[model samples]
Every structure is written in structure tokens, then in C-alpha cells.
Target chain A: MIAASFGAGGMNMLDSQSRDLIVGHGSHRYKVDVHWGRLDPGRVPVKDCHEMAVDSQGRIVLLTNHIRNNIIIYSKKGKLLQSWGTEYPGAHGLTLMNEGGEDMLYITDTERHEVIKTTIDGRVLMVLPYPAEVDAYEDASQYLPTETAIAANGDIYIADGYGQQCILHYNARGELLNAFGGKGIEEDKFENAHGICIDTRSGKPELLITARQQNKLKRFSPEGKWLANIDLPGAYICRPVIKGEHVYLATIWSGDGAENTGFISILDKNNRLISAPGGNQPIYHQGNLSPMYQQLQLFKHPHDVCIDEDENLYVAQWNAGHLYPFKLIRI
Target chain B: MKAKHRGHSSILFLQKIALAVCSIVALWGCSTNKTFSQENDIRLSAPIPQYSSTLFEDSFCLSFAPGYPNSHIHFTTDGNMPSRKSAIFTGKQCFTQSIHLKAISFHPHLQASEMVEIDFLQVKRLEKVKAISLLQEPSDSYPGGGASSLFDLQKGSLNFREKAWMGFDEKVVEIQLEFEKPQKLSQLSLSTLQDHGSWIFLPEKMEVISQDGSVLSQWPIPQLAEAKRLAYLHVSLDEIETQSLRIRITNADVIPDWHPGAGHRPWLFIDEVILK
Candidate 1:
């Protein structure tokens, strides 16, 4: 394994803009590893480094839309392991699941409007196409899948965040079970529902989804019943990542104008944001989260974050000059 | 044997020089876009210039305070991106008539900040407001400073949520501003924000009327065939006399079919209403 230490000599390799800086606060503070993943673009080009996931073998898997190598796997030490796949042109989301003792992956492609199930080595398992049965969608172009969540029973929940603000449920066999939520003015409706995840934190399985444009997270029953709404006044969160009793998020953008201001947030069991990795301290006035923004410009459009077994974070960004992921080693 | 050993040493020296050159090039490439440390972040928007409510004189001189230390501020009044060649604010500036001053701060190694624009209008101040009312209230998110915001003589930035612009969604805005006494008005103008992609559009039409139900002037806001930048719409009325000014601004109603929010309700944002 490559050494994780950045001794005195290695400091000279960092850019003058970011030589030695620490971000985050409280229990989530981190020391940045800027040179964690440096690959020659000519050899392995990446467009938008959208999302990341860690496999059971501890290999950090990154999903980019770059057709040459859609999936780039790296070691915990930031060494390149292997990369494969070129069929997915608009690879946006990646979800790694361990099924029957084997690691599997679900990739959502917005360009083709479909959800693909593949093995760790790029073998196609099942393809969940657009929902033709839904009356709201007369054709396939109206459904753009952005994310997915797997249930304990192998049910797959797909979030159509780009084209339509809704969630599609499919059983283990890839059969559509139900579709709910849409663009509306109702309290339970969504506006740019970008990410979704199955939450089992409260002892019962439920759904936690991101209403990105509205800056809120909506919780629903496994059957798609609206349970509650968590308001994050100014944060446009990408996805809800559950690790143990804490929930992590990569805020893609913030501010009233939706500028390219982004940061990482950590919430406690009750869903109260207690820590922001690169932003202001979480302050609540009468139970409402005041506007939050990037206190340290450490992240620009942080689309998703993958936490390893060591609790280190790998942050993938979007539209940030084609840079690779940044490693945040927990302090 | 001596000559052969000397030749081998010379070749080794040349190889060492080539290795040093390659290492320098590699280090330079790595420094191009390294991840930023927290302390080197680009500062937020430049501080807005502080000025008076109205200019009573024909021409006025203004000054600016530095927003970020160790930074150079470039300013422009023609609605263009300020460059290094632009006017570097030394201390103050002088202006005649009305001008929109947009400025940005630039630090050496940090990123440039977003532009901050403020408008200074040279108009006569009214004695007092008799009464004011709005036919339709603005959206709760951007009620602005309320009816008083229209006369605050301050322009809104591209960011309309700065508590300066009153935003109306799919709704017409009818405002009546009564002066302390009847005054002869020759010109009337208002500014609206046009960020089409964000679902904000210029008002379709504007009508100015008098308390006696006489139409002073009416004009249609022209839609830009192609809008690639954040834009503003300023419409002025001809000479007219009125006691109470009744202004009506019609919204675009629905976004154009070519827009991403084609079927959604478009927003109308108005920052300052200038009456001369």
C-alpha cells in the first residue's frame, strides 16, 4: 500500500493555491489530501466525476461519464487499480451493493433514461428501462433517472431527478411495482428530487430523498407515504449517505442565487446538522437552520461523497475543471 | 583504460542533467490545478458602494471602500466585464445623470469575486409619500423591503434575493404611489431582472396612469431574441403630468416553449422604480 503520509518533501508538490489547509469542524474535521488521485488525463480522461462507492474489498470505485473508462477503481492509498466499461455515456450515479456475498453495482444513465445493473467487473445483469406504464410519461425521454436505493428485499428505488421529480420502485426481478411523486406545488411533491436512499436508522426501513431545488429532504414510508420534511434552508444537497448513526451529505451548491458554493454536512441521529466539513458551524435559531455556505472554498460542486471503513471521505465533484476526487482524512 | 573510464563519466553527467529537467517539468504540471486549501479561497462578493439616496446636483462625485484587503478593484458603468485595463478605483468617481456601477475584486492567487452593481439616480426627491398600496403582493420569499423598496433608490444585483427586488410569480403588479402634492412628472422608469434560465423574465408590458384615470404612457417590453448574459430592462415614459402614479407591470405569464421551464410560471423581478 502507498504511504498516506505527506512528509515535508511532499508538501512542495501541492499547488500554491492550496498548500496546507484543513477543513471541517468538530468531529468531522479533516486534513486534505490534494494529490490523492492524480492520473494522466490523456490516458484516463474524466468529464464530471459524479459519484463514488466503496466495494467490500476496500477498493474505492469512482463513476465518471468519461467514455474511455467509466469506472475507475483505486486503492485506499489512491493508487490506480483498474478501470472498465464504455457503454454508459451519461453515467451519473453509482450504488454498490453486496448481493449474495458478491459485490454488484447500479449505474443510472440520464442520457439513455435507464438504470443499469452490472457486476463489479462490468457484466450486465438487468436493465430497468423507463416506465412506459406511467401516464405522466408518454415516452421515454420524459424520465431521467439520477439515483437509486436498494431495499432489504432487493427492491430498487430509482429517483428521476432530472427529467421528472418522482421515484420508481422495482422488485428484485426488475419489475416495476409503483411510481409516485412528481413536479407539483403540494407539500409532499418535489422540485428537482436529485437523490434517494433507503433509511433503516429508526429500526424500520423508510425512504430519505433529496428535494434539491427546494433545499429540503423528504422522508417517506417504504410504500411511498410522506412521513416528514427536513428543511435545510439554503443547502442543495445531493444524496443522503447513512453510515452507522450519522448521515453525511455533499452539498452541490448553495446561496440564494445557487452559486457554485458547496460543502459537506454531517447530521446526527435526529437529522439535525451538527457538523459541516468545509462550511460554517451549524447554528440554529428557533430550530431553523440559518443559511449555510462554503466557509473555506475547499469544494466546488461536491456531487457525492464516499466514506471508507476508516471513516475517510472521497469527494467527487461536477463541472470543476475535470479534476479528480479529494480525500478528506478524518482528524 | 584511462580514456575509456573518462568517457563513461562524461555520459553519466549528461544523463543526470536530463533527469533534473524532467523533474522540474513534472512538478510544474502538478501545480496547475491543485486542490485549494481553506485559507486561499476566493473571497465573497465585493462590498457594495455606499452612496446617497438621490443626487440633487446635476453632477456628483462618489468614492468606494475596499471590500477585501490586498485586492485590486476594477469597475465599469457600461455593463461589461471589468478587465485589468478597466478603471482601477483609486479613491472616488464622478458621474452625471444616472449610472450603473459594477465592480469586482481581484486577488493575486485567489479567484475573482462576483460582480456587485449599484445604481445612482439623479432625480428630484419627493416631499413625502401620501399613501401606497399594491394590488398583488410579491412572493413571500422576496417581498423585498415592501413598497418602500421601490423608492429606496438602490438597484438590485443579479442575485434578486438580496432583499432589494420584489419578485412576482405569474402575477401582475399594480402599484399606486401618491406624492405629498401634485407634481409635474416628465419621465418614469423601472428596472427588471432578466435571467431567463432561472425562470425570471422581463415584464411583458408597462402602463403608467394618473389618478384621474388618464393613461400617460404604455409600452411593451421587447423580448431579446437571444439572451446569453444576465440582463436588465429599463423603460422610461415620456413627459406626463400626474398626481398619483398608477403603474402596472404585466408578467410573462409562462416561460417560452424553448426554455427548460417551458410550462412553469415565470418570475418578474423589479428592484427600483424611478420617477422624475
Candidate 2:
């Protein structure tokens, strides 16, 4: 596996089959994720980050849980860039894309019960308010969007993380294509699909989705197939980001507030843990630190992550208002 | 000679004084028709500025006047945020007809505010509630799946728990709800663990029995593919009201290949059975 680094510069054509590590770290200052999700043990609650996306500029975007209104941006060096959006009272997962020639943001507000698309500047571009056909919800605060994945055609895959709890498919133009994925525990099905990724790990583009509660990763063809389910571990194993030969994920081990400590695990193509990213660090478990001796250099509650051509890591931290970015070097 | 010089100078001074008086009179007379008037101070206290309510086609527009003509007024319906567009005042209704004028005030930066707020509006049909789920159960039954629950709540009476239904082979769940009267239902919504379609289910058995243990109706045999998992079910609430209606489904079929026979045991999840 390539060694990991935290900063700057290089250009080498890399293959999609290369090995890489997803490093992680958490801080005590910028944990604006929730009341219990602060950095210090007196405040921060437990929240593992989930579903992340990389911008064209190589920045990372993160979405936190336990009372949405969580969003954070960061540079490759893990510097907190700009962060806003504590509006999703019931927020779950988040994804980013380019719309009007810029890194556009799409967030699923499970509480407000709507899907919002905005510019990086936080201007509301389009609001695909609650869809009508899905038998989702009629109440204002019931439509919960857990995660979102983009298709090449701009179609959006919305994981109904909470509320109606289903996978909703929409066209790039924000039209309802088809709505699937609901409450179940099956190989071809999902119990709680907390994470989703549309990757080309296969020769062709396919949907590499993770069912958090099921501890399984299922890949589907673009048309939505029950292709296969790979195994993963942890109680609340969340969204999966498919890198070269490995798939990265976040798993929650403790509390429910911002201070809750989480672990990040990497799985090979066969879905086996290569190494746990934040598993070695001191997690703020119930006031004192939960002593994990692994000493992973930099990570905590890695809810979501992404890899670029340069092997840089862009992670969206859980309970953090900002994203932490690192790079996998020649270690 | 002295007298003549004094007279000429005095005459010139008097002429200058007369011209100044004439100009002053002209300025004073120009203020008559202008009332600071046209009720420029007339302002509205309702129908907030940026608020929008699509409750009606031709909604009522609350307006104000007698105040600043175009001094920049701002308001909110959904609170704090005004609509994107800016509207000018004809002094009669600068906002829209639908705004309840819940609250209005001159934008603070524009100087003063003669604010007005209307009481909660009678929002004739303010919002339309399409469906309401009666079941709200959370499930972590599947390993390696998601945090999403097995089913959502809806306007039904049969919840999976009350129906003795969990899940089945191919992970398909058969749902059946019973009521007292016959209801015309054109559509039925069922949510699988990771899916959201297919209403008709293969039945090993479909029988509706009354509280007296009498069979009210026996569902016909059918062939429907086994579903991924049963999430939520939706059927119209337009019929009978049997306090206790038993819906039995067993020996289910997975695919809609052959007609579903009364063979294998099927799952029965009745979330909310509503009878009209």
C-alpha cells in the first residue's frame, strides 16, 4: 500500500488499480456537527462521517448526522476552507458535483423533507422539494434524504436515509427516474443503505452501494441489478467510497453525539479490512478516551472519503463542519 | 445733485428687493397640490414582502401606502427570507395578492419602518397532504445493508408488526390488509428493503376471515415475483370497518413465472388496515 502524507505537490499518471491508504484525524476545535459532537469530551457527541465527494479543485465535502445542518469544506492539507449549512435538521449523507461550471452542492434534508441543490456560494439554484409519486411522506419534516450519488448523465441517486427510507432516482434535470431501495435485509436488497458510489471499478460504470446496517456492499449495473454483496464489519458500517483496489468506509463504535468516536476501515476488492484508519487513535468515549493502541496517525469518524488521480484523500468527517484531506504517498 | 444721486441708488436697491420677493412667492405657491400627498404614508401591515403562498390561483394581495413611495420595503412569509425578485410599488400592492402581509417593514437599510403584521391567515387549503404513513418502524435486521428502516409510515391500517410478517425467500414480503367494506384501490405502494415497486404478490393463501371465524373473502391465486423485502404498503381507505380482520398469506412465489399457486408459506405484513 502507498504510504500516506498530509501536504503538497506531484504529478504522475496513476492507474485505477493502484493500492492506497485513507488516513484520518479529528480535532477538538471545529466540531460544529452537533451539541454532543464537539471536540472535547465534555461536549462532543459520537458521529461517524459518511458519504463524501471531491471537487474539481481537489477539495473535500463532508456530511454529518444527528441533526443535519452539517457541511464542511477543506483543502488537501486538511485545512478548514469554508463551511456552512446547519440547516438539515435531519441530515444524513451528502455528495458534490459540477452543474453551472462549478462544484455544485446537493444536500438531502431529511427533516425539512426536501432535496436542495445550491452553488458553492450557498445560493439556492434549484429545489427538488419532496417528490410526489414515491409514497414518501406528506408531512413537512418527514422527507429524509440520507445520501446522494451522481450518474454520468447527471441523474442523481438519493438515499432516503431516514423518513420514507428508500433510494430515489432522479434525472440530471431533477426528474424522478425511478425510486427504489427501502427497508429490508437481503443480498439484492438493503436494510439501511447509508452510503452510495457510482464508480467504474468494473470495466463499465456501475453502482457500488453500501448498506450500513447490513454490513454488505452491493454493486449494481447502471440499470439497477442485484449483482453482488461483499461483506464488511461493524455495527453501523456506513457509506463506501470505491478507490482503486480498495473500498473505504466509516463505522461507528460509540456514542450518539458529536464527541462520539468512530473508526474507518478499508476493504480490498474482496471486501476485507486492509487496515482501520482511525482505529488507532484516542476516541473520546464517554468522557475519557477509549484506549485503542493502534496509533493510526490521523483520523476519527471518517464518514466519507474520495480519491483523485493523484491519490489524494478527500474525507468528509462526521460531526465536523469541515472536511479533512490527505494524500497517500510512497510509504 | 446729492438728492438726485441718493434717489437713483435707492431705486436700484428697491428693484432688487422686489425681484427677491417675487421668487420667494413662486416657490411657496408650488407647494399647494402636493400633499406630501397621494397618501404616500399609506402602508400595509399584512402580506409580508418575500412571502409566497400558492394556496389559490388569484390570491389576495395586501398593500400599504401613505408612507415612503419607493423607500424599499421587505418582508417574509417563510420567515426572514424574502423572495429572490424585487418588486416596485404602484403604491397599491408592490408585493403579490397572495402574501398574507403577515409582516411588512421598510428594509432597515432603507431608513425607517412602519411595520404591520397580519394574524395567522385562513390559508384556505394551505397545504395538501397526499399520504400519511401509520407505521414508523426502524429495522437493523440486515447486516451490511443500510440504516434505512424496513418500511415507511402511510395512510394504512396494516403495519407489518401486527400482521405477523417479517421477510421471506428472495426476501419478498407478502402484504395483505382486511377491512369491512370493499374499497376501489387503483394503486398500492410497497417499499422493499432497497426497492419501491410491485404491488401484486404471489399468495400461498389469501383468505379474509371475520371475528366470528367466518371466511369473508378468499383472495384469488396469482403469480407475482418475489420482492427484495417488504418495506411499506399503501392501499386506499375507502371501505368496511371490521375491528378484527385476518389476512393470511403463505407459501409465496418469488418470480411471476407461473401462476402463484397456493403452495408455499408467504409473509404477511399489514401495517395499517384502514376501513372507510
Candidate 3:
């Protein structure tokens, strides 16, 4: 194991392979390794390891609410390469987008109530403030964007999950193009529009947004038309990560009221649950998929999933102590 | 111009009073458990009870991880909530028969944690139960291991979504348990999950009846209505010898009006049923 290093002091490396717990179901099974990113809490503390993404260079980037080092970059072998960012106190979401040839990151800070586009090395390129141009936002605090999806044409779609619960669309230059998907109980509206992604599974890029509180994944047109909904009862899922023909999600919670209950769900091109990594085997009764829950205690409140090129899953959790990310080696 | 200036000054005075009153009301709202100060709002997690074996041969020692360092734990044996004034847990206590242990953790600034209950039963010369038939089956989502779950000699944790819980929705559950021979039953108790915000509530009532449809004994399960991690309901029955028994539990049916999901069907979750 590499010697663990933090801000100034060195800490002992953690070895969690002794647990030897095997988790998941079907072809997506994995052996768990919980000590992948353990850090010294005094020097580099983490409140919530919220979201993670793998850049084109195959480096794993993690985002946490801890202001000391909000962004942590790790090698594929679970070695800490570097860490940066102290301006984001509520760094909740991280999305990596490639523009032209270089990788750019869009970070949504709930405390800042803004979406920031930055170079991979922590240089702020652009910042998108609350859409004061829209009538829904009375002030900046009412626009806590949680996640963003970038289009191929360089447009940004922001999900105001913790605030007015709407989606704000913006052009590349931080100009408002259109804003839709406000808070409501209808199919087009949302309760917690936590995450969004551009789906290219059908070759025609569409919007796959997570209505987290409603436990459904909604597909919308580029112009914000409600197309279809893939209902996952009892699964309050987070963002959708598309890897090739399959879609993966880190279900943040299940059961009720944001308890420490979660699982990793994998869906096929048809949007049907093919496997659940930490939950029971997905069983469909009649035409509805049975409510799924965590069977093994492998995860608690999994906020995001980052799958490397080797198909291994790195799970970032929330409210599960100050523990580090858990790596699931694909079997 | 002087009269108009006075009028504007009076309006400004009235606005100041309104703002003061609003701030007071907001502060009062925050004081009533709806919100708490960060210093005093430290998490007092429920105690995790560990046993040598939930189904032990004779007697078993009960041990658990402390909720926090230097915290005191008080527990009870009669299925009541534990308070700071309750008996402190010194070490392992030897018990002759079955018992229900309810514990609470206390810290300096943190609020007392909700009670955590663990039940231990001692099997003796009682007849073996054969099968159990339900009038209405539980939800397909949580079938709970079918008939074997009742006396499987296992317990569930705070996470009721595990396979240990038998969950039912929208309907009451009536069960008929058949025994191989007549046996004496003096006590019956079970654990249920109570998370009002999650639409899982405690049972409304519990009743025991004979195989001939005569009411044997009945008791009302108290409705805490608040968020509790777990609830253990134990009712002492007069010693009765019976070949079979019928158990009936009334469901919450609808979420209470105070809850967010008012008028909607709530869930009923029961894990293990212990008898002696």
C-alpha cells in the first residue's frame, strides 16, 4: 500500500481487504474494498463524498463538501495524485465534459448557489449565476443547482434540486436560453430534479433526468418535452451514468425519508433494471418491478458511481461517517 | 407637508413592530424540536445490541457498542422507554427466562436517542409450532421468509427493509398458527418499525384468539406517532393451554392527518414474534 499523505501530516494506510465481502448480483457482481480513499480527517476532512467522474485521461476525480480539499484526484490503483479547491463549501455535484480536446469540469456548489466551469487543474473558466432573467428565481438562494448536463453543442442544463426544483437551460456563454421543468407532481415537473445527463444510447441525444423524490427517471426532448418515464418504485436514484449500451445509477436512498439505505442499480438500453450491486436481485412481479432495497450492508447513501474503463465501480457515499470511497472490483 | 411626514413615520413604526414579532415567532418555532442549535444537535445514534446468540441454549450475555465515547446508557427490562434515571447497564446480566431490553443513550449536549429494543427467549418444553396461514399475505416486495420467520430465532436491525421484516400495506394481517400439541403460552411480544415520515407506523391493536374463533386476549398497541427507531410491544397473557392460536393485527390503514402523506395508505412492518 502507498503511504497515506494529507495536507501536512502522514497517516497510516488502511487495509480493508480482510473483510472479504462479495456484493452485487448477476453479471455485475464485485468484491468490495472500502479503504480505497481513506484520508486523515484532521488534515483532509470530508463531510459528504457526493459525486465522482472519470475524465478522458482515465483519472478518477471525487468531489466532497469539505472545504479544505473539495476535489481529490486519485489514480486507478487508488493512489492519491493531487487535491485542490477550497472555495466550494457545498460542492455537491461534479461533471466532466470534453470541449474540443481538453477536459473541463462543471461543479455545482449548493452553498455558492452557482454552477462553475473550471479547467481540470482548478482554474475557474466561467461561472453561471442564478437565472435572475427568469421569473421563478426571486433571489440567488432559491437556485441551488445540484447537477448539470452539458450538451454536445456546449449548452448547460442545470438541475435546481434543493431549491425551486427546476431545470435551467443555459448557452455556452452563460446566457439563459430556456428554463423549464419546475416543481410539481405532474410528469413534466419534478420534486427533486437532482441529476441530469445527455443520453446518446439511441444515437439521437436526449435528456435523461432524475426526478429523485418521485422515484422515476424521465426522458425528455432537447427542447424540454416530456417523452417517457422509467418508473423505479422505492428507488430514489441519483444521476445516470451511461457507459456504452448500459446505464448505471447510484441509488441514493430507498425505503423512506432519506434513511441510510441505498444500492447500485444497472439498467440496459431498454431502461430495465438488469442488476443491483448492493441490493437484492431485481424481480419483476406482473408488469411492475418489485421494490428493491439493500440486502448486504455494503453501502450507505451511495450518491454517485464512477465506472473506470475496466468496469470497476467506485462508490461515493453521503452521511456514512467520514469514511472514504468504496471500490467494487468487477468480477 | 408636516402631517404627511408624521403619517409616513407612523407607518414605518408599525413595520418595525411587525418585523420584530415575525422574528420572535420564527425563533420560537426553531426552539420546539423542529430545529436545534448545532452544538446541542449532536447525533445520539441508537445503540446497536449484540448477542452471543439471539437463540441461545440457556442464558446469553448482551453486549453492544456504545453510541459514543464517554456516554451513559440506561436500559429497562419491562418493554418501556429508558430514561437517564433508569437502571444503568453495568455488565452482563443473567436472566432465567425471556426478557425485552429497551435502552437509550445519553450524552452531554445531544438529545437522548430513541429507544432500541432487543428480545431474548428461552425455549423449554413447549410444543413445536407447525405452520402459519395468513388471511391476507404481505406485500410481494417484503414477503419476509414466509412461515419460518415468526420463530426463526433471529432479530432485525433498525433497517427494516432487510429480509427480516414482514411488511404489509393497506390491509390488516390475520395469522393462524398451528401447533403440534397443546402448549402453555404465557407471554407474546414482537418488534415493529416506526418511522412516521416514511409512512411506516406501529400497529393499532393486537389480539389473540382460539382456533374456535373465541377471543382469548387482546391489547392495544400504543401509538407513539413520532419517529422511533424501533418499538417492542410485549403483552403478558394469562397462562392458557391451547393447541392452536390466531393472531390479529390492525394496520394503520391511513397516514395520520399530521403526516405529509395524509389519507394515503401507510405500511406495517413486523419482524420477529417471540413467545414463551
Candidate 4:
């Protein structure tokens, strides 16, 4: 496996402002296998990027919370392929659905208070409204969704992301099947329950959620049973990807510091610690101040991580607005 | 013989160099995205709190603490941390005038506050709390409600669907409140952006809860009606003395009598819940 970047060797890869990713790069000769950071020089050239989803064909889709305009799609890398939805003024959540390399992309627009499905080519396939349980009607704010997860039977799990902080489940037809989660510090209680992913770590369709404020990773059954509470130290936990048997998690930083160091950590299925490769330190920028002039080898925030078929790992960073790709090669 | 041996040695040397280059190339730029085999050489600490700040009662309240400088302080007087920053906390001199209060300092380590309550009489909402927009107003869907729905097409609700549908219509939607005491109710207005349907299902009973399950106040709404537009209710507090008050919508109207949206569903549109 390989972690690819714009280029190698800190050679001012981008014309815009640069952000460096600091992973554990051992010395050259003794390093039988090591990982290095390459600068992705191209600017994303978008207004605001909040949520992202990659289709089976490796197409990148994103939801922005900026204006009514939402849901932008791009190529596998940093290339801006195309854009759509001046209609979704309050778009925030998105996910790709179906089996057999399906081209369907599902989106949630808080502004319009609706979940929509379309082709990867960007045509409105179907319009799914809120489930009967959520007061999206009469309470427009309740319709405001933050994130989305797809079920095997084409059912959609919409995290009433911002509206009511609840998990609203809908059949593939956009029918509200069941709903779970509320605003609380309790087990299934969500405090800005931001991001979610479907996990089979428990050998079932378990809903894995990142409750932002509570600072925990919570797993729930499809019928909404409290499975486990993932304990971590950071205040904000961003997006999570449950790969095979491991989870690579980091921070959602608005500032710099090793505290919010944005370290990439590996945790097992039961929500216990597997390990944090570089402790909790991620790659960071060194501000002139020098402990022997060491550039920060920690992270600001590692927003999203994806594992390709080859087990190559790609991470999306929020603050730096950079995409860091790395290969998981065991030496 | 010497030349052949020399050539073999040189070729072997080049082969060695090639191996070194490949090893370096493979080793170079490896990602630390996975877990570290051993604990990395690092230490994790909290954001240093000892920094000065400014509370722009209307614009922005910034805390100058070290570490995670990007951490936004999303707080509320109703003891709710809804969004990153969605609380409507009112301070003295905060209504219409822009109140600029010097941001106090943070002690870095404690993550505690030297300043908790920003004088309410001096703080106000940066933007006006939106009013109840009835599908029409200078409305977002001003053309008409029938023309295009306001909320979600993936129609579902927490109250009437899950909470009410699961048991009875008892789970209360946590609205805002007076953290210290009650305020004015004259300019009280309600605007809703409909997601799917508009129907406030109320039971034959009403129970008021104040920190306990005991009824603090009780009222009964004996009917269920088809709300043409968003539902609106207003209560005026004389001196504003209620604390942690909950108004649970108890009456329910289900389609199948088992689950909601079983046959067909209605909608309620709301854009904002403004109580001035």
C-alpha cells in the first residue's frame, strides 16, 4: 500500500498557503518501510466544505453549509470535476448508496429540509422528505440534518444533524422507519451528534456515531440499542471510518496545539485503545520557536480518513484544508 | 580474470545502490494514519487557559486561550449547547445596542472559567431572533405553501413520529428559557419551516414538570386538528420567574395506531422559533 500526495520532500508543493502533515517518518537508511508526507499543492477551490462522501467509483462528493448551494462532487483526488445544487441552500450531510458499484448519491439539505437521491452524474433521482417522527414540518429547524448513513436494505439513517440531535431512520423509499437519540450526555443521548458510520464490528448493522460535545464514540443497534461508549480525551471528535477491525480517529480543531494535536489513533472494536502511533502528537507547524528547531510533528485536526481496497489510507484535514494520503505498510 | 571480477563487483555495487534507492523511496513519505507500534515520543496536554478575551455581546465572544485556538465556545443561558454557537443569551444593555465587554482571562490548565455568566443585562443576540413565518411573510416560501413545501421531503418527526409514536406524545421539545428569571412576552412570535406535515397532536391531559415528575402546572387540550399552516402557541410571563420549564405536547394522532406514516402523513412548517 502507498500514501500518495501532490509531491514529495517539502518542496513548496502548493502555490497557496501550505500545511504539513507530520506522521512518524523514521530515518532513511534504517527505514525498511516508512511513511512520509507529500504536499497536495492544489487548492480545493470551494466556498465551505462540511461533509464528504466517496462513491463506489471513487467519486468525491461534499456538502457545504455556506449558502443554499450544496452538494459538490469531484474526482478521486483533489481535482474539481463538477458541482451542483444551487437549490440546497442549507446542505450539510451526504452519503453514497446501493450495492454492485451503485452510482446513487444521497444528500440531506437542512435549508430545504429534505433528503434527496441522485445519480453520480448529478441528476435528481428521488426526493425523500423527513420521516413522520421528526417535526421537520412546522419546525423547520427539526428538518435540519447534520449527517447521513445508508442501511443494507436501502434504508437511510439521517442524523437530524443540527435540527434536534436525533437519529432519524428511514426506509430506502425515504419513509421514516424509526428514530433514536436525543440531546443528552447519556448513552444514546447526542450533544451535537455530528458524524455517523455503519459498523459490522459487532457482526451486525450497528450504527456508530460521533457525539461531538460529549466527546465519545457511541455504537447503537439498528433498532437503537446502546451498544458501547467509545471513550477518548479530546473535546471534539470529527468523522470516523470503521475499517475491517480498526478505527482511525482524530480531532476537529479550530486552532493549533498538541492538546488538540489531531493525532491519528488506532482503536479496537470494543472501543478500547489499540494504540496511537505517534502518541497523540500529529504533524504540526513549528512557529519559529525551536526545541532544536523542530517543526510540529502533530496535527491540527484530522477530519476524515478513508481506506481504499488496497488498504491505502487517506485523511482529510479541516483547518489546513489539505488532503493527506498514506499507505499502511507493515514493515 | 581481474576484469571479469571487477565488472561483477561494479555491477553488484550498482545493484546495491538500486536496492538502497528503492528502500528509501518506499520508506519516504509513509503515513502515520494508523496506530503506532510503540507509544510515540509525545505528550498530550489541555489548552492553556491563561489568556485574555473579549465579549462582543452581539458580534463575537472570543477567549484567547492557548491550544485549540479554533475551539469555539458555544454556550447558552438555558444550559444548552445546541450547535457550535446557537445559544440566545441576553445580557444587560444587550437588546438593541452593541455591548462590548472586555474578554476576561482563562487559567489555561483548569479549563474552568474566571467568567461564567456574562452580565445578561449587557448582552444580546448578534442577529434578530427570527419570527414565526407562516409559509408567507416576506416568507422564505413567500410565493405559497402549496407551491413548494418548506421543510423535509424525507418527511419524519421526533415528537409525533418516534417519541409520541413509541409511547405517548410525552417527550418535550426543549425550547429556550430565561436562565435567571422571566422576561417580556409582548413581542412573542413563532415562525416555522415545515419539514413534512403540520399537526400538533395533544391528548386529553396536560402535566407540568419542574425538575421532577410531579405536575407543576396542568392543562388539557381535548382535540386534534389538521393545521393548515405551522402550529403557534404563546405564553406571557408577568415577571418571568420560571426556571427549566417544560411544555410537553401530550396529545398524539397516529395513522396505523401502531406506527406513523403507515398510510399517509401530514406536515407542519416552521422557519424559526422566535420569542422576543
Across all candidates, what is each one's fraction of true contacts kept? Answer: 0.14, 0.00, 0.00, 0.00
Candidate 3 deviant stretches above 4 angstroms: A1-19, B1-276
Error of 1 at A20 (Å): 3.1
Q: What is the interface RMSD of each candidate, in Å?
A: 16.2, 32.1, 21.3, 19.5
lDDT of 1 by residue, A1-331 (tens): 0011111121232235553345666677776776687788999888899999999999999999999999999999889999998988999989999999999999999998899999999999999998998877888899889999999889999999998788889998999898899987576789988999989999999999999888899999988989999888768899999998888899987655344568888888999998887666677899998777654456778999999997989999987778899898776
Q: Model 1: clashing residue pairs? A: A18-B37, A24-A277
Docking quality (DockQ) of candidate 3: 0.02
Q: Give me the runs in candidate 2 sitting further than 4 Å from their true place.
A: A1-52, A63-71, A99-101, A136-142, A254-261, A278-300, A308-330, B1-276
- Total clashes, candidate 3? 0
DockQ-based CAPRI category assigned to the predicted complex of candidate 3: incorrect
- Tens digits of per-residue lDDT, candidate 1, B92-204, equal 76778778666666655445555655556677555576877888899998898888777765666556666777889855789898888776766666766666646777667
* lDDT value, residue B17 of candidate 1: 84
lDDT of 2 by residue, B75-128 (tens): 455433232132433344433342423223342112222233322222222122
lDDT of 3 by residue, B1-276 (tens): 999999999999999997788678654332232221222322344555656534455777887543344456788888666766788886666776778777776655444555665556675433488877878788898888776676766665556667777889946788788888877777776667776656787777777776433433333333335544555566566777888887788775677776767888888888767677
Report the number of the highest-DockQ candidate.
Answer: 1
lDDT of 3: 0.76
What TM-score does chain B get in every candidate? 0.63, 0.23, 0.69, 0.24
| Model 1 chain A weakest 10-residue run by lDDT | A1-10
Residue ranges of candidate 1 with Cα displaced over 4 Å:
A1-19, B1-38, B41-117, B120-157, B160-275
Taking every candidate in turn, the Cα RMSD to the unseen true structure, in Å, is 10.8, 27.1, 20.4, 19.5
Q: Least lDDT summed over 10 consecutive residues: which range in candidate 3 chain A?
A: A1-10
Write model 2 residue lDDT over A1-331, tens digit each, in one string.
Answer: 0011111110121122321222334311111111112233222222435555677787766555433335655565455566666566655666778865788878776667778887775677777777677775566555667778888778888776655556778888888888765677756667767667787765688787777655567787766666877655332456777768777666643221112245555665655555554443333434433322222213445565566555544444554434333233211
